[model samples]
Target: MTCREASEYLQELMDTTLAPDLERRLRAHLDTCSACAGELTLQREIRRRVAAGVPRQEVPSALRQKVREILAPREKWAWGFLPRPVIRWGMAVAALVLISLIPLTLLQQNREERIASIVIEAVNDHRSFAMRVNLPTLPTADREQVRELVEAKVGFQIVPPMGQRGELRLVGGDVTYFLDRKVACILYGKGSKLVTLLVLRDEGIEATEQGFRQVNGLRVYTATYKGTGVVLWKQDNLLYSLVSELPQEELLGVAKEMAKI
Candidate 1:
């Protein structure tokens, strides 16, 4: 399997949900890739912590007392109505099964909530940054020159759109953090319009065609964001969003151009 496919299935492998053949493929990849191996180790640690930390519920005192009473012997004639030993054993087994399911159900709920929290935190951070910054000044040089300067100074390779001559004019940019991940936000302008392009390590969101999502009135576009006549695409696992009060069509045109790049 390819590295990307292996990476995608790593979580399933950790959860022991993958079919044996697929699991073997992923394991083989992990054995060779140090990065994937480290990721697997971290995932295993997280699973262990989650399992260890989730508190198991104890049987309620009232229920325990009731069970004891039911199991106790009685000399009264009414005892003749009691269940046979086999029926009693079946009921006990059913009760145990039901009780055992409670913890697993709670654990599933907790795991889902934890994942949701992480995604929400990432989206919120993006939204918060959008609200705080001002647009930067337009670049004085050509797009290629600006890209070269950015690469030299910022250490990130910036590729401009195809068939476009300096469509996005570089403005100021900043480095920021969200949820322990470092991010770089570059301000750019197309003509008189201004926008923000964020280069993040990763937002932890799955890649999909439904890339644009709005959170708390902040319009976030993943892989690409368009504003005015400029489009931005995320390159190198970094997220890029053009935050501008521009027309959607123009933004889409810019996105198409960037996709070629």
Candidate 2:
């Protein structure tokens, strides 16, 4: 979809009401276009700030009566042919949906806030490698040495995936802890694009409702967090989350390929 069309549907996209095909194209466009990504981020931030500033108050009975009176004539004209009971039921369902959105929106905000912090930490750690901070335990391409180092540090046997060996070369790896559990944060590079593959135990991590998808017997969670695309999944008892600037589809393709190893 063109950028103009994308802008037109941005509200629906935020509400998660767009058709699946359209939503896919929109996300694809956002992935490669930094300008659009920034615009989306700005819009979301504005919404969050506005929501935070807004006061929460129950609708007054007089105001509700006025709104119903204003819509009564239009509803009567629009649904003149429909049965009264059917119209009443339709209005009830619409009210139910409106009422439920309040809590659902809050729940979504909390989930995104929590996940965003984790994603930001991962992204920052990925960037820290360039600064030569918290250097990897093993720097060679020897699989045996890397595996031994990872296992010894994290207490879990890990076979770091060889990502496009030459194109996306694995530079080195080190162990890090998340929520007290061992995590093997492996670093890989492809020209300017740096990828960090996190391997850890999935004991307490919760899969997001909208972010969860399945691929080749694995449960995948995909999200664009803090301007970075993250692909997370579980294999056996191990959880893996890959963080990068790659598009969602491209990231998923790379992830699936890596899972083969």
Candidate 3:
């Protein structure tokens, strides 16, 4: 191949195996052209750095299915103008080019974005309740009354810490939508900082598992999503998620206290 032709196919040459004749000509040009060889070295180094710095993230199932659908062969394609082998080869090359361009960071971002959406939903719900014009919903500090109201809507009772007098007091109770299902929220505030204790039936919410800890005989799972601290535990077939911007220690303390109830 001439120097210009070799340069055009350099990336493809580096990426995959080429036809024997094409590979032979490219190597012949490289042997005579020092500049092209140096350019090839630089491209390899850049690719190496990109591969080393970014860890591979698994493709999401939905994206994998979509890719499969796109690559699936049709019954009688218009590309029949080309031989079957040629069509297959062209499709493979196109698929490889498309796949190579997808960065690992993109997959990681998809997962983080999903979790962030949940966090945003929680934050918005809290802000809406805090900024309400009036108490349009039930406002009660009574544990039994709040539990009955929340359980009636969510099928999960809000269990407060074992004492009537505690640092976190239940100011009110309300219902909110989380993952298309009703979530029972019990509002509590120590001072200016508000805490939303969300109780619901676990339906496999996607959360990165932090560390599991035993607190007050309950296996508590701790995780942070989008800078928001989250502590979840299960009891009586229901899941309790304590979400707030509070420090991890403070949040864990609240979760432990609730677990004691």
Candidate 1 residue lDDT tens string, 71-124: 875533365666689667877999999989977864565533433333444344
Report how far residue 248 has shifted in candidate 3, in Å.
Answer: 2.1
Candidate 3 residue lDDT tens string, 1-261: 677898887887888767778888898999999988998888989998998999889999999988877887563466767888997899899989877865654455554454455556766676666666534266877767777877788765565543234777678887888755788888887656667777766555444333456766667776675666777776666667777778988888777777755
| Candidate 3 lDDT for residue 126 | 64
* lDDT agreement with native, every candidate: 0.56, 0.76, 0.72
> Lowest summed-lDDT stretch of 10 residues in model 3?
203-212
The local lDDT score (0 to 100) that residue 246 gets in candidate 2 is 75
Candidate 2, pairs of clashing residues: none
Model 2 ranges off by over 4 Å:
1-117, 164-166, 206-210, 215-218
Decreasing TM-score order of the candidates: 2, 3, 1
lDDT of 2 by residue, 102-166 (tens): 67764565654545555666767766665677677777667667677788888777898875544
The candidate with the higher TM-score, 2 or 3, is 2
- Comparing 2 and 3 by lDDT, which wins? 2
Residue 192 C-alpha lDDT in model 3: 69
- The worst-scoring run of ten residues by lDDT in candidate 1 lies at 222-231
